[model samples]
Every structure is written in C-alpha cells, then in structure tokens.
Target: MKEIDKIALIEIKNRQILHVRSKGKLKFYLPGGKREASETDEQTLTRELHEELSININTNTIKYLGTFKAPADGKADGVLVKITCYTAEYTGNLKPANEIEELRWLNNSNLDIISEASKKIFEFLKQKGEID
Candidate 1:
C-alpha cells in the first residue's frame, strides 16, 4: 500500500472548519501540504499555511489534533493519504495563494465536497463538539 504523508492545519471559526480547493482540484481539503525533505511537522505546517493560505502559523500555539488515513482521493485504489493534523493560531487574513484557487469555511453539511481523509477529521471534530 502506498501512503502519502501530509501535515494539515485545522482552523475552525464559529464551528466551521477552513477548507481550500487547489487550482485544478474538485474536492476541498484542509489547509496544508506534504513535508519537504527532512522537515518536521511544525515546519511543514508553518510553511504550507504561509504558501497556501498566505498566513503564518504560530508554531508556539500548535497543538496536535489527530492523524487520519483513508484511500487517497483521485488516486488509485490502495493508495492512502495519512494526514497528521494540528490546530494552531495564525497571523494575517486567509487568502488563496500559490496553488490554491478558493477558500471556504465548511460544516458537516458539506461532507460530500471534501476528501475522504477530511471526512474523518470532520467526524472527529463533530464528535468532540468542535464543529456542527
């Protein structure tokens, strides 16, 4: 089985989680990306948020949420995406940058529009009463 490791940020506001769609992607995903060579999770999160959302993640406030894995969306069967999630404070307004085409705050009702790994995260946050 192939696993794609990623680091993601869980930014919630008023019970809605931030989701982003890449320029050519259909499913909205949590803000983050794959780690660069030898980069730590915090480093990846900080860099990706800045690159994708035009915001800086406050590394000091970073907290581990959970890790989720599911069949990679739009990839072949048996290819899984392993997302390591974190919640952190950020600076600056969120705007789509780099490869991001759009940003949206999503709730449980929008499940069908997100990736499978994101679905796992939404379910986790919902169970914890973090998102509606």
Candidate 2:
C-alpha cells in the first residue's frame, strides 16, 4: 500500500474549521503540505501555512493534535494519506497565497466538499464537539 505523509494545521473556532482550496483544485483541505527533506514536522507545517496563507505560526505555541489517516485523495486505490495535525497561534492576515485560491471557515455540512483526509479530521473534531 502506498502512503502519502503530510502535516496539517488544526485551527478551529466558533464550531468551524479553516479550509483552503489550492488553485485549480476541486476539494478544500486543511492548510498544510508534505514535508521537504530534512524538515521537522513543525518546520514543515509552519512553512506550509506561511506559504499558503501568509500566516507566521508561532513554533513555541504549537501543540500536537492527533494523527489521522484515510484514503489519499486523487490517488490510486490502496494509497493512503497520513496527516499529523497541530494547533498553534499565528500572526498575519489570513489571505490566500501561493497556490491557494480560496479560503473558508467550514462546518460539518460542507464535509462532502473537502478531501477524504480532511473528512476524517472533521469526524474527529465533531466527535469532540468542536463542530456541529
């Protein structure tokens, strides 16, 4: 089985999650990306957030959320994506940047529009009563 590893930011407020759409993509995803060689998880996530949303994440304030895995979106069958999530304080205006074309604060009703890995994140958050 093929596995795609990624790191993600889990920023939730008012029972909603921050989701982003990459340019030309059909699905919304949590703000993050795969780690580059030699990058720690925190470094990877922090760099991804800044590149995608122009937000500087406070490395010292980062908290490890849990890791979740699901079928990799847009990949061949039997491929899975493992996403390690973290919540952290950030500084900057949350605007679409780099490959990101749009951003939304999504609730459970919009789950179908997100990637499979993101669906699992929402499920975990919903079970914790983080979103309706």
Candidate 3:
C-alpha cells in the first residue's frame, strides 16, 4: 500500500468550516496539499494556502487538530492519504485561486460533498462542539 502524506488547515468560523472544491472534482476538501521535499508540516500548509487560496497562514496560531488516514481520493483502494490537520489564522480574503474552482463554508450538513477523510474530521469537530 502506498501512503501519501498531506497537511490540511481546519479553518472554522461561526460554526462553519472552510472547504474548497478543486477544478473538475466533485468533493470539497480542507485547504492544503502535499508536503514538499524536506519541508515541515507548517511550511507545506503555508505554501499550499498561498498557492491555492492566495492567503498567508499565521504559523504561530496553528494548532494541531489530529491525523487521519483513508483511501486516497480518486486512487486505488490500497493507496491512502495520511493527513495531518491544523487550525490556524490566515491573512487575505478567501478566494479560489490556482486550481481551486469554488470556496464554500460547510457545516455538518455538507459532509456528503467532501472526502472520507474530511468527513471524519467533521465528525471529530462536531463531537468537540467546534461545529454545529
């Protein structure tokens, strides 16, 4: 089984979580991407946000949420995505940049539109009373 490592930022506000839909994709996901060579989780998340959303993440405010693993999106069953999640403060207006096609705020009701990994994250947040 191949393991893919990625970072995700769990941006929440007013009981809603931020999610983005990639171009040509049906699922929405938390804003983030794969780690670059020798880069730390924080670095990867920062770079991904800048590239995908044109925003700067505040590193100091980043808080580790938890890690989750699930079948990689659109990949073989044995392929899995090992995601490290964090919550952080960001600068700049949220907009769809780069390959992102749409940006939306999701609550519990929007779980079906996201990936399996993200659905797990949403459940975790809901259990902690972080999202409505």
lDDT by residue (tens digit), candidate 3, 1-132: 899999999888899989999999999988999998999999999999999999999999999989999888899879999989998998999889999999999988887799888888888998999987
lDDT of each: 0.95, 0.93, 0.92
TM-score of each: 0.98, 0.97, 0.96
Q: Please give the distance, in angstroms, between residue 82's alpha carbon in candidate 1 and its true position after superposition.
A: 0.3
Model 1 quality (TM-score): 0.98
- Candidate 2, residue 85: the lDDT equals 95
Question: Model 1 scores what on Cα lDDT?
Answer: 0.95
Return the lDDT, model 3, position 27: 97
Which candidate number has the best lDDT? 1
lDDT of 2 by residue, 1-132 (tens): 999989999988898999999999999999999999999999999999999999999999999999999999889999999999999999999999999999999988997899998888888988998888
Model 1, position 34: C-alpha lDDT score: 100
Off by over 4 Å in 3: none
lDDT of 1 by residue, 1-132 (tens): 999999999989999999999998999999999999999999999999999999988889999999999999999999999999999998999999999999999999998899999999999999999988
